[model samples]
Target: MLIFKNLGEMASLEYLYKYDMYFAIFQLTFIALLGYIILSWLFRMWKQYKQLKNDKASAELALLKSKIDPHFFFNTLNNLYGLAIKKSDEAPQVILKLSEIMRYTIYEGENETVLLKDEINYLEQYIEVHKIRYKKTVNITFTKVIEEENISVAPLLFIMLLENAFKHGVESLTNNAYINLELIVKKKTLIFSVENNFEVKENAQTGIGIENLKRRLQLIYPKKHELLIHKDTSVYKTQLTIQLK
Candidate 1:
């Protein structure tokens, strides 16, 4: 106030002295603000780093999962062709169902996520067609413990697992073969459990289906999903649990 009241060189000296004491304070404040900005920028960079990692993993997993559809469709079509060549009475209905499965597998299966209930319906339809194709030899038992209206899941994820269970389990059975599915939704998590009976073969293999399912889970849910598979002398059991996002 005294510096502002006076004029000339005397006032200039007084004003400079007064604010000189605050010079260090202003420098410190500027430094603090700059540090804060740098820290915020680093935090944003770290978050982007994490997101990029997740995206890369997802892209790789999507590529792996994309491989599954071709193999699956090829095998299914081969199976259907065999049925056609046999001149079976159920061939017409089998073709219609195949068309539906193809549509779903090609179109809906490409999505990142889908209603869990819809995927389940697609699986049931596919299994039914397969049951018709393999009617004489395979016995399938499917049980649903979760209401389909309440849940959603990553699209086409569980189908490959189910397909593998049936392929290996059904192919090895001489008679009385059964595949059982139980879906349980508890709180915010969903548990899908499948068990199938199969004869012990010398050349049993865990094919591309299992690998694809693993990659899909890692990409889609990462630490939020759990997959467990148990193979005993005669029964193979698989359980996948995912925390709904």
Candidate 2:
């Protein structure tokens, strides 16, 4: 039996024990809540950073593809002007082709991916436009074998190679200038090969377009693409392979 002179002087060990336990539980709950909040904030920040990086890449690619060479448009326009003055029967066809090319470049080129067939058609149109501008005979053969259907690719991925081939190969040589291109799509893979004869001794394999293409491949395809270049005394050959997802 115990008797206390003052009731307030009595401190029960059981009550003290209960208080300690509740204080510890409260502390743990508070720490857990703080940790959860911090982690959630970090996760949100990481997601925002990733999204921003992707958006930047997309913007850069759009700028790159939208640059369809102002010189090309100027020359085509000047040529069309002359043809129009002469009332040439081919003026309408030329104008139509030009319009189609512009439409595709302005619209479809901005897309992340486009149909392989559409890209092929755009390439053909580009070739036709170039052929019309030159008086010299430029033998260009583009062959394609697409076994896989509904395939998609990053837009304007191969135009730089074609542009480089013509700029260094066909434009410099006076005779026997040729560009041969082949595209093979099979087994969920796309292979594009270009071979051209060049006369320029230097700077045949270097250009802004090709450099940008390299950057783009790194960004878009990463490990899924392979680009190979072969050069000899008078020929430049390149092959690009892409693994379709």
lDDT of each: 0.80, 0.86
Clashing pairs for predicted structure model 1, backbone only: none
lDDT by residue (143-235, candidate 2, tens digit) is 999998899999888888888888878877989899999999999999999999988665544557777787888899999999999999899
lDDT of 1 by residue, 20-101 (tens): 8699789999999999999999999999999999789877866876677454466667777887898877778878888887
Reference-based lDDT, residue 27, model 1: 93
Structural similarity to truth (TM-score) of each candidate? 0.81, 0.88
Give me the displacement of residue 140 in model 1, in angstroms.
0.7
Clashing pairs in 2: none
